[model samples]
Target: MATLLVLGFSSGLPFYLTSKTLQAWMTTAKVDLATIGFFSLVTLPYSLKFVWAPLMDRYTPPFLGRRRGWVLITQVLLLLVIAAMSLHDPRTGLKMLAVNAIAIAFFSASQDISLDAYRTDVLETREMGAGAAVFVMGYRIAMITTGALAFFLADRTSWNNVYLLIALLMIIGIAATFVAAEPVLNDAPPKSLAEAVVLPFADFFQRAGVLRALVVLLFIVAYKYSDSLAGSMTTPFLLQAGFSQSEVGAVFLGVGVIATIAGVVVAGAAIGKIGINRSLWIFVVFQGLSNLTYYGLSLSGKNHGFMVSAVITENFGLGLVTGAMTAYLMSMCNKRFTATQFALLSSLMAASRDILVAPAGKIIEGVGWPGFFLITVAMAIPPLILLPFIAPWSSDVPIGAAPHTGETIPARRPQPPLAVRR
Candidate 1:
C-alpha cells in the first residue's frame, strides 16, 4: 500500500506539470485562451500510450523485474525531461515548451502503464477498493504539490525554478522504485510482442463480447468527460476571474486538498459496502453537479467565498469519482495483459481529457463561462445513461471480477491460460 501510494504520486507529478501547471505558466505568460486550449494536444501521448504498451509487456528490463524496471526507466527520463523544460521560457520558447511537454507526457504515460500493471499484479482481489483509494490519495497529493505548491512557488520564485524543484522531486519516485517488491505473477510474461499486442484485445473481446465491450469502452470515455472538459480551462478561468496565483494555490492547498481527500476516503469506504457500480452511480451525479459551483463563480466574479466553495465542491466530487473509476478500471484487467489492457482503457479515458476537451477554448469563447460549464454538466449525462447497460445498478461485482473472491461470483467463467488457447 505504501509503495502504491508513492508510485501513484510519481505517476501524477509529470501529468499536471505538462497539463495544468503548464497551462498556469502559459496563462501567466499572457498566452491567449485559444492557444492554451490547443496546447492540450501535447498530452496526446497519454491518449495513445496503448500503442507501445505491448513493448513494456513483451520484454523485461535487465533489472527490477518487468514492472519496476519500466517504472524506473520512465521516472529517470521524466526527471531529465522535466528539468530540461525548466530552462525554456513559455513566452519566448512556446514551441520548445510544447516539445518538452510532449516528452514529459510520453514518459509519464509510460510510467503509468508500468505502475498500473504493477499494482494490478501485486494486490489481492479484496484489496482492490482500498488500493484504489490509497493510490488516488497519493495521486491527488502529488497533484497538490504540482498544482497548489507549484502555483505558490511560481508566485514567489521563477516558473523555471518551480519546474526545477518539481524535477528534483522525481527522486522520491526513484527511491520508491528501489524499495517496491517485484510482483510474482502465476502467469508468465507474454512470449512475443505479437502475443502481447493481439492477445490483450482478443482476450477482452472474447470475455465481454463485441457489443458489451463497445459499451464498456464508451462508458470509460464518458464517465469522466464533464470533469475533464471543465478542468481543461480551470486554471485560466481562475486567473481571468481576478485571483492571483497564490490565492488560487491557497484554496487548492487548503480546502481543495482536504475536500478531495475526504471524497476519496468516503468513496473508498462506500465502495466496499455498496459495491463499485452503485458507488459510481452515486458519486458521478455529484461529479457532474459540481460544475454548477464554477458556473456560480463565473457569475459572482472574483468573490473569494464563491471561489472557496467552488474549489471544495468540484475537488471533492473529483476525488469521489476518481476513486470509483480507478477501482472499476482495475477490475476489468486480466493479470497477464494488465499493462496493455489498463493502458488501453486509461488511454480512452485520457482522450476525453485531451482530445475531446480540445475544443473547450472555442466553445468557451462562444458560450461564455456559464454556458460552457452547463455543457460540461450535460456531458456527464451520457455516462449515466450508459450505466444501466454497462454496469447495472443491481450488480455489485465487476464484469470479469478479480481472481480469488470467495464470496463474489465472476460475471463470466475464467478462461484457460493464453498458452493453452494459442
Candidate 2:
C-alpha cells in the first residue's frame, strides 16, 4: 500500500502541471481560451499509451526488471522535462510549453503503465480492490496537491517555481523504483514483439463474450462522459458564477479538495464492507445525482451558500465514484496486458471528452447554464442504464477475465475457443 501510494505520486504529480496548470499560466499571460484549450489536447499520449506499452511488457528494463526499470527511466526523463518546462515562458513560448507538456505526458503515461503492471503483479485477486483504493487515494492526493496546491501557489509564487517544486517531488518515485521489489511472473516474456503487442488484445477479445464484451466496452467508454462534459465546463462555470478569483480558490481548497479526500476514504471503507460491484452501483447513482446538485446551484442565482454546498456535494461524490470506478477498472483488466489493456480501457473511458469536451463552453452558450447542466446530467443515462449488465460484476465470468464471450486473436490461430480474460 505504501509503495502504491508513493508510486501514485511519482506518476500523477506532473500530469496536471503540464495540463490544466499550464493552461492557467497561459490564461494569465493573456493567451486566448482556444489556445489554452489546445494545450489540453496534449494529454492524448495518455489515451494512446497502448501504442508503446508492449515494449515495456515484452522485455525487462536493465536496472529493475519488467516494471520498476521502466518506471525509473520515465521518472528520470519526467524530472528533466519538467525542469525544462520551467525555462519556457507561457506568454512568449506557449509552443515550447506545448511540446514540453507532450514530453511530460509521454513519461507520465509510461509511468502509469509501469504502475499498472506492478499493481497487478504485486497484489492478489482478493486484495486488488483494497490496493486500488489505496493507490487511488494516493493518486488523488497527488492530483489535489498538484491541481489545488499549484492553483494556490500560482496566486503567490511564479508558475516556474511551482513547476520546479513539482519536478523535485518526482524524485520520490525514482527512489521508490529502486527500493520496491518487482514480482516474478513465471509466464515467459513475449516470444516476439508482435506477440507481445498483439496477444493481449487477442486474449481479451477471444476470452470475453461478444455481447458482454461490448457491454464492458460501452461501460468503460460512457461511464465518464457526463462527468467529462461537466468538468470541461467547471472552471468557466465557476468563473462566470461571479465569485471573486480568490474566493474560487478558497472554495476549491476548502470545500472541493477536502470533501473529495473524505469521500475517497469513505468509499474505500464501503468497498471493503460491501464489495466492489455493489459499491459501484451506489457510486454511479451518487455521481449522477450529485451532478444534479450543480443544476440547483445554477438556478439558485449563483448564491454563495448554495455554491459552497454544491461544490462539497459534487466533489465528495466525485471522489467516491472515482475511487470505486478505478478499482472496478483494475478488476476488469487482464494482468498480462496490464499496460496496453488498461491504456485502451482508460482511453475508451477518456477519449470522447478528451477530444470533444472542449465544445462545452459553446454548448452552454447555445442552451444557457440551466439547460446545459440538465443536458450534462442526461448524458449519464447511457452508462447508468448499462450498469445492470455490468453488476454482480458479470456473474458469469470468472476472476481475471470477462465472461461468456469469445473473439479472435490475430497472431496465433484462426479459430480460437472463447475464453473469459480478466
Candidate 3:
C-alpha cells in the first residue's frame, strides 16, 4: 500500500507541471489565455500513451524487472527534465518551455502506465477498492503539492525554483522503485510484439463482446467530460474573478485537496458496500451537480466563502468519481495484458481533458464563464445515462468474466521465471 501511494504520487506529480499549474504560471506571466489553452496539447502524450504501452508490456528493461525498470527510468528522466525547466522563462522561452514540458509529460505518462500495471498485478480483487482509494488519495495529495504549493511558492519565488523543488520530489518515486518488490504476474510477459499489441484487445472483445465493449469505451470517454471541461479554465477563472494567488492557493487548491481526500475515502467504502455500478451513478451525479458551484461562484463575484465552497464541492465530486472509475478500470483488465489494457482505458478516459477540453478557452470566450460552466453540466449527463447499458445497477459481473461463456477467464499466457527487482 505504501508502494502504491508513492508510485501514485510519482505518476501524478509531473501532470500539473505541464498542465493546470503551468497555465497558472502563464496567466501570472501575462500570457494570453488562448495560448495557455493551446498549451494543453503538450499533454496529448497521455491520450496517446496506449500507442507505446505494447512496448512496455513486450520487453523488460535490464534493471529492476519489467515494471519497476520502466518506472525508474521514467522517474529519473522526469526529474532531469523538470529540473531543466528551471532554466527557461515562460515569457522569453515559450517554445523551449513547451518542449521541456512535453518531455515531462511523456515521462509522466509512461510512469503511470507502469504503476497501473504494477497495482493490477499485485492487488487481489477484493483489495482493488481500497487500492484505488489509496492511489487517488496519493494522486490528489501530489496535486495539492504541485497545484497549491507551487502556486503559493510561485507567488514568492521564481517559477524556476518552484519547478526545481518539484524535481527534487521525484526522489520519492525513485526510492520507491528501489525498495518495492516486483509484482509476480499470473501470466507471463508477451513473447512477440504481435502478441503484446493484439491479444489485449482480442481478450477484451472476447470477454465483453462488440456492443458491450463499445458501450464501455464510450462511458470511459464521456464520464468525466464535464469536470474536465470546467477544470481546463479553473485557474484562469479564479484569477479573472479577483482572487489573489494566496486565496486560490489556500481555498481552491488547499481546501480542494482536503475535500477530495475525504470524498475518495468515503467513495472507497461506498464501492465496497454498494458496488461499482451504483457507485458510478451516485458519484457521477455528485460530479455533475458540482459544476453549478462554479456557475454560482461566477454570480457570487469574488466571495471567498463561495470560492471555498465551490472548490470543495467540485473537487470532492471529482475524487469520488475518480476513485470509483479507477477501480472499474482495474476490474476490467486481464492480468497478462494489465499494462496495455489499462493504458487503453485510461487513455480513452483522458481524451475528454487532453483533446476535447483543449479548445475550452475559445468556448469560454464565446459563452462567458457562467454559460461555459452550464455547458459542462450538460456534458456530464450523457455518461450517467450510459451507466444502464455499460455498468447496470443490477449486473453482478466479476473480474475477468467472459460474456459468452459466463465463466471466469484466467490469464491466457503461462508464467515464466520471476524477474528480480533491484
Candidate 4:
C-alpha cells in the first residue's frame, strides 16, 4: 500500500509540472496566452501512451522485473529531464522548453503505464477498490504539491528553482521502486513484441464481442467528458473571473484538493458498500451536478467565498467519480494486458475531452463562463445513458475482473481465447 502510494505520487507529479503548472510558470514570466496554450500540445503523449505500452509489457530492464524496470527507468529519466528543464528560460528558449516539456510528458506517460500495470499485478481483486482510492489520494496530493506548493514556491523563488525542487521529489518514487517488490506473474509473458501489442485488444474483443466492446469504448470516452472539459481551462477561468493567483492556489489547489481526497476516501467506502457498478452511476451524477457549481460561481461574479464553494463542489465530485472510474477501468483489463489495455482505455477517455478542449476557448468566447459550464453538464449525459448497457446497476462484475470473466482469477493469470485480429 505504501509503495503504491509513493508510486502514485510519482505518476501524477510530472503531469501538471509539464502542463498546467508549467503554464503557470510561463504566464508569470509574462509569456503570451497563445504561446502557453500552444504549449499544451506537448502533453499529447499522454493521449497516445497506449501506442508504446506494449514495449513495457514485452521487455524488462534486467534490473527490476518487467513493471518496476520501466517504472524505475521512467522515474530516473523524468527526474533528469525535469531538472534539466529548469536550466532553460521559457521566454528566450521557448522552443527548447517545449522540447523538454514533451520529453517530460513522454517519461511521465511511460511511468503511468508501468504504475497501472504494477498496481494490477500487485493488488488482489478485492483490494482494487481501496487501492484505487489510495492511489488517487496520493495522486491528488501530488497535484497539490506540484500545482499549489510549486506555485507558492515560485512566488518566493525562481521558476527554475521551482522546477528543480519538483524534480527532486522524483527521488521519492525511485526510493519506493527500490524498496518495493516486483509483482509475481506466473503466466508466460507475450511470446514476442508483436503478440504483446496485438493480443490485448484481440482478447478483449473476443470476450466482449465487437458490438459490446465498442459500447464499452464509447462509455469510457463519455464518462468523464465534461469534467475534463471544465478542468482544461480551470486556471484560466479563475484568472479571468478576477481571482488572484494566490486565491486560486489557496482555494482550488489547497482546499479543493483536500476536499477531493476526502471525497475519494468516502467514495472508496461507498464502492465497497454499494458495488462498483452502482457507484459509477451515483458518482457520475455527482460529477454532472458539480458543473452547476461552476455556473453558480459565474453568476455570483468574483467572490472568494463563492470560488471556494465551487472548488469544493467540482473537485469533490471529481474525486468521487474518478475513484470509481479508476476501479471500473481496472476491472476492464485482462491482467495479462494490464499496461496495454488500461493505456488504451484511459487514453481514449482522455482523448475524448482533449479533442473537445481544443475548441474550449472559442466556446467560452461565445457563451461566457455560465453558458460554457452548462454545456459541460449537457456533455455528461451520453455516458449516463450508456451505463445501462456497459455497466448495468445490477451487473455483478467483480472489482478488477478479467474482461468478460465474472469470476476473479488470482495468482496465475489466464487469457481468454483471442479473437481474430481484424
Q: Write the per-residue lDDT of candidate 1 for residues 77-139, one digit (tens) a residue.
A: 999999998789777888888899999999998998899988877766556667788888888
What TM-score, over all chains together, does every model reach?
Answer: 0.79, 0.83, 0.80, 0.85
Residue pairs of candidate 4 with colliding backbone atoms? none
lDDT at position 281, candidate 1: 92
Considering summed lDDT, which 10 consecutive residues are worst modelled in model 1? 404-413
Q: How high is the CA lDDT of each candidate model? A: 0.86, 0.75, 0.83, 0.84
TM-score of candidate 3 on Cα atoms, chains taken together:
0.80
Ranking by lDDT: 1, 4, 3, 2
Runs in model 2 deviating more than 4 A are: 23-41, 86-98, 147-162, 356-367, 393-422
lDDT of 3 by residue, 48-99 (tens): 7898888889989997777778889889999999999999887889999999
Model 3 steric clash pairs: none
Question: What C-alpha lDDT, on a 0 to 100 scale, does residue 322 get in candidate 1?
Answer: 86
Best by lDDT: 1
For each of the candidates, give the backbone clash count.
0, 9, 0, 0
Q: Taking the tens digit of each residue's C-alpha lDDT, what string does model 2 give over 1-422?
A: 78778887776787787677887888888989888877878987887788898888888776667777788888999999998877888788777788989999988888888888777666654455566767776787888889878988889988888888889998888877777766656557677889888887777766666677778787877776777787677777878888788887789877788887777777777876776677777776777777787888788766888888878988888777777766666666665666667767777777756765878878888998888888877877887787777655544222335321112121223586899889
Query: Poorest 10 consecutive residues of model 4 by lDDT?
Result: 403-412
Q: Mind giving the per-residue lDDT tens digits that candidate 4 earns over 240-350?
A: 999989888777657787888988887878887777888888888889889898898888889888888889988888888888888888877876778999998888777
